[model samples]
Target chain A: MSNPKEHLYQKTAFDLVSGFKNKQWKAAEIAESFLNRALDTNKKLNSFICIPHESILDHATLLDEKRNSNEDLGSLACSPIAIKDILCTSGISTTCGSKILQNFTPYYDATVVEKLKDKDALIFGKTNLDEFAMGSSNENSFFGPVRNPWNLDCVAGGSSGGSAAAVAGQQCAASLGSDTGGSIRLPASFCGVVGVKPSYGRVSRFGLIAFASSLDQVGVFTKDVRDSALLLRIISGQDSKDSTSSSNFVPHFLDSLSIKKKWRIGLPKEYFQQGLDSEVRQALSQSISLLGKNKFEIEEVSLPHSDLSIAAYYLIATGEASSNLSRFDGVRYGYRASNPKNLNDLYKRTRSDGFGYEVKRRIMLGTFALSSGYYDAYYKKASQVRTLIIQDFQKAFEKVDLLLTPTAPFTAFKIGEKTKDPIQMYLTDIYTTAVNLAGLPALSMPCGFDSKKLPIGLQLIAPRFEEERMFQMAHYLEKEFHVQNSKHHIVL
Target chain B: MKFDIQTVERIAELSRLEFDAQEKEILLQDLSKILHYVEKLEAVDVEKIQPTYNIIESECFFREDQISVHLSNDSLFKNAPEVQEHFVQVPQMIASHE
Candidate 1:
């Protein structure tokens, strides 16, 4: 009835798979549609760093031929999924949005990339991100800032900003983003998409370029809650390569979506108490009331140490980042300094020239924290407070099935709004950081829009390894909120 | 604590980074402000709590000790600034040449 291009470009990945299964369209046709859309708008949005046209079409053509011959098709038979540049794809550059690894191509796929391919999903392209997932906005990217599709003057939140913008712009049906602190959810909230930060160790981190080893987790951004669940089910499972990946059985996440049991949602008193935008607060409270009307119990809970989350998180993340990022010296691989006089110059020049401002700042902050006399005063104290933050969540979950909060303090600010003030930028993820510090699962979905028409994100966090419950609650919330089809209306 | 230029320079040296004079001045102020903000952690009274460096309960996972195929020299040297036969070349380590 409508122009088929609209449906083709905007269909949920689930429907697209169903469309392919019915022989309604060839895999090549679907892949071509997405590639064309991505190419059409990437310049305006700056959502992608590189789009390998030849490789993507070649893979799609092979998939079409196999489909025509009636071969076994995987879940994402023809679906095109965008990966944040941080994920390593074999033979493609995994830059982690830094100049140091600009030309470095990986020889093997990350565990998640392998899983996506195993399910026959097309590797859409590498999306831009904050360099090494450091900054809260995508402006830190070496490529450029990822403009929010809804309002080009505004920024798409980072470090998964490019992935969020790509999904928001209809460049891809869905995408993968990484959340260290609020990387995925912050951007998703800004771009009006569903982003999930799965429980730590729930998904293997074998090939995710480590930001903060303990806090970094791979997550998905999609048009709807169900696609988030589908991707989670596919990518999660124990990988022997990632020693931290849980050996527990990966639960049937998609199957849990149909179970419509009402949940007891906790509204953290601290989250609502301060620094929340009035409009954003109004929308989150509306979503909570809608849940209460739908028979879900709502109760006020306390995370007393919540105010200290940002401080502790920055210390721990940078300390871990300092240790994790030390491997990128001149000799091994990636960008090496041009002409160093000696070994020390080689190390100094390579790192100084290779890393950007925010990366250097964090590395130094971490070095200071972990340095000789300061270790007990800084890093050690922060880690101990980290224990209290974890215990707070553990205790809160005993009272409620999930805790709800705003994914970020405000909607997408204008480009360069918070860049000059690093503290202002860091405060954007205040509510989301504590979840990562505690190692929990959370999701951000479009609840409503602010006065500027930029989307507001509602965050729902669950206990560790309880992603099934997280998905169940988010699925129910989305249905109740009736915010259906609030996706991909990019101005470009 | 005041993060003076000397402290910034020392920390940068420890981090194996060498910033220009202007950048160092900016970093001194930025790091001082950020560190001042992070001073909130010291007030949390972490007297008896044990630091949690990891979340997973599993001890060090032991994979079978097996020699297998690793990355070939070509891929390993692919991004090297300078490469010799199957090896990455770098500047001389000692202060004086041999």
Candidate 2:
């Protein structure tokens, strides 16, 4: 018999849950297998900010006791999963990688965390992220940037960078990330794993700390497409708290993957334009070519206002961020300035001291955009452009079943490479941001490696609530290219 | 369109944030560059396009009127920076003579 413990870190959550359900091995054994891997390598990658090492064993033993007693256990019993720091975990410090919330412990669980607990998944640790989910690279984290498992010098892309790196580093079997813009996909591409950002409102945003309320969606990083689909199935449903949460019935994502038909994939002409790294283009071409050979029809489609997406995304996200983040003024929770002279000093000093550089910059821009004289010029204009971008996608989707594009302009850049140039850093999400503007479901899966052996990500976007269709494409492409959920093969 | 120190100070005041001189100098340049980039949005003719305030088109649903213990007062105040008795203490919003 094959030793399940030997490959526990490499196994998918799907496999782990099945093993647990069948009572093939104890849940404590699988949890310890991953705990050992996380403890050994997490220091080097800086993937985990806080690991519930003792809690994992505690939860695992309880799960095992339940199994032994013949008690009912949820679908995912004792499968270890890492959570991004942005999510609220009861009694655990949920910092959102910002000093403002440095030591804040949430009194209640985020809806997603509560859901994972309901399924009996071992909520392993809180991974790092860009402070307030602001930066494109993980460098903006209060905790140090998460290093790409493939190359230590490069970044695991942000703001979901840590979750991506931890999974790629094999520190966890799977992880959850919140994607505002390309936080999940960029890092997933950088680290060579599967990242899925479901349709907006498909999942509850109740427990997630908001960045841009309209754009942010909780997603997952896993070894393969189905694991992502399985996790999505477990987490997505309407919640009483999140009024925006869709009342649409959740679909059976894994079973629905059996739909086999020729998918007419649309290739955006804008994405292949200048500035796309030649190597990335080659990897994208090869992945699409493999799909073409597999009987999937490929055609060139255009999103005319695509180039304008990044600018609109920044204006809209920052504007929303400025409003959403204004609640953090050292009153009810989080870091408070000592001995404030008055209320106004408390607000100014508390924010000035609490927020990091990039976060401050975004807040400044957002404040400027939303400011009276400039609102009609900056925020209003950007909102109008966002409408145009949405229309562009709407028009394109009418003719195509799915759209394929490069997830990022290039593979992981060096940690400090573009930190100085905020504009250059923002360009990393060039291809992926527009999808969020249109509020579509998209998946980023590994296609191939660059000359430097860094992984390239291929993004497949579907019309709203069409994640199953997108996953069908991702699964087929992953099989054909043999790149779905491949491990980073990087030694810490 | 011209992002200057006055503009920075104005926005910073509005944003309730303060930055040192060195940081302010950097913010001036960075904010100017970003605003310049956002200038491209002005070029796109969106005469009749309505701004998308919310992406998902769903009517807000009001829950049945109810009141219950969602969280205890102590748990809600667990992370408060300053709590007096059962209430969150904050700096005086208005100067008061006692």
Candidate 3:
């Protein structure tokens, strides 16, 4: 008989939990299967920065012991989950894909890490990311870019690329990612997985290394919609440590997944305009036609300020990034400069040597925007534009329960294709950045595949704090698309 | 929208970063292209709009002033580059009298 552990790595977290309850597989067996798969795939994918093999197996063995004692277990009991390196893990090296923190380890766990541990989820490893979560493609990482499972030559979309790639590659059951201006959704699209970016303040940011305090949010990357719901429920809630975390009730997201309703979905005309790939556009049209046949009212809507999102997002995001990233002075924690001539030399050289090219570019841009004479002309103007973008979404939601759009303009591109031109790279987030600007809950799920067999993603965005509505709609569409079984055919 | 070397240097100083001449030249080109793109924000009229610094509707919360367990000095200093008896070492700030 084939070893049951052989295919355990392919099972969903939800199915793994059920199997555990049925006494079919021990937690240690599941952990070993995933760990073996992860180690074997890391050489090609470069998805994980570090994989703690011994600790993961030990944690799973402890969980198996608990099961033997007939003790009640948490929802995620023994499922192997990967975390984006930006979040602090108490004893593990939490490098945010940068050389600066190569040897730095956090003294305490992030709130999300604590929550996952409480649910008995085995955090097998920390995934790679664009350095400081800056770029649109995974190419900006200091370690190396994560290779797309669908097409090895192409990039897995960024700053959360490794998180998305880990799930798509089946190295981990699910992974956590942080989204700031389409980081999670774009990668989800490229990697053909379900990614959710909850409304701002929906999840606590206590130990998530700050990229843009206003825009950064913790999210999840999963193989399917139901797995996304299960993971999202476990990691979301208010914490006294993060005052910005909403006290709004955290509903059982999985329980609400099957409640089908003929909700109105809006397709913003501007999102479907020029620059979108022909195949992606066709996929969106097919999905819309299917929705129409099912009696869901669909209509064209206008988000007039959509064009200004990239401009405003870069300004505001980089502005906050400049201020937030100033803490890495190299004295308290992380890499420190050697043989500094003076204090100024120490600070300058430490940052200059620590940060990568893209990071320095952003810091310079943000500093210039917030500099003494240019404050009103840049930062204030962008903030006003941000207000208008938020208003655009609010107005659209008045007519429809949710909005549907292509998650990205196209499928993944060749790794070095857009790396030369920063503008070309920034434009990759054109459709996805607006959702973060409005602080709305949005998710990207695979709706169809391109002519080349690369997955195409459809984004459904709902009003702030209304994640349940988004999940219900995505789950419905997921069933209709029947793309659930179309897993990535990457030969490990 | 073109940024010169001096302007790049000034901004880098403010950012507490340093770049060599080649890197600075690239930054100049990149910053110019990016800021020129961002210049589109100037066309929008914002006469009456309030700038949103944050979207959280609730007021700032204050925790109760009770003594609680917190990170110990040992743990806090564990990641410090140079630590000696609970003090983080750094470059000398004041000029010594000759």
* Best model number under DockQ: 3
Clashing pairs in 1: none
Return the TM-score for chain B, candidate 2: 0.85
Q: With candidate 2 superimposed using the best TM-score fit, by how many Å does residue A427's alpha carbon deviate from the native?
A: 0.3
DockQ of 3: 0.86
Angstrom error of the Cα, residue A97, model 3: value is 0.6
User: Per-residue lDDT tens digits of candidate 1, residues A1-492?
Assistant: 436457576878898888887888887788888888999999899999989989989998888888889999999888899999999999998898998999888888999999999999989999999999998889998788999999999999999999999998999999999999999999999999999999899999988999999999999999999999999999998887899898778888888886466778898899987688999999988888777777788999999999999999999999999999998897877888887888888899999999999999999999999999999999999999999999999889899988999999899999998988778899999999999988899999999888888999999899888888888888877887674335424567
TM-score values for chain B across all models: 0.82, 0.85, 0.91
Model 3: docking quality category:
high
Deviation in Å, model 2, residue A459 alpha carbon: 0.1
TM-score, cand. 2: 0.97
TM-score of 1: 0.97
DockQ of 2: 0.83
Candidate 2 chain B minimal-lDDT segment of 10 residues: B61-70
Position A233, candidate 3: lDDT: 87
What is the per-residue lDDT of model 1 for residues B1-98, given as tens digits with 9 covering 90 to 100? 66799999999998999988999989988888899899988788789999988888877677787774488878766777787887778887757656
DockQ of the candidate models in sequence: 0.79, 0.83, 0.86
Q: State the C-alpha lDDT per candidate.
A: 0.89, 0.90, 0.91
Candidate 2 C-alpha lDDT tens digits along A27-94: 88899889999999987899899998888899999999999999999877877899999999998889
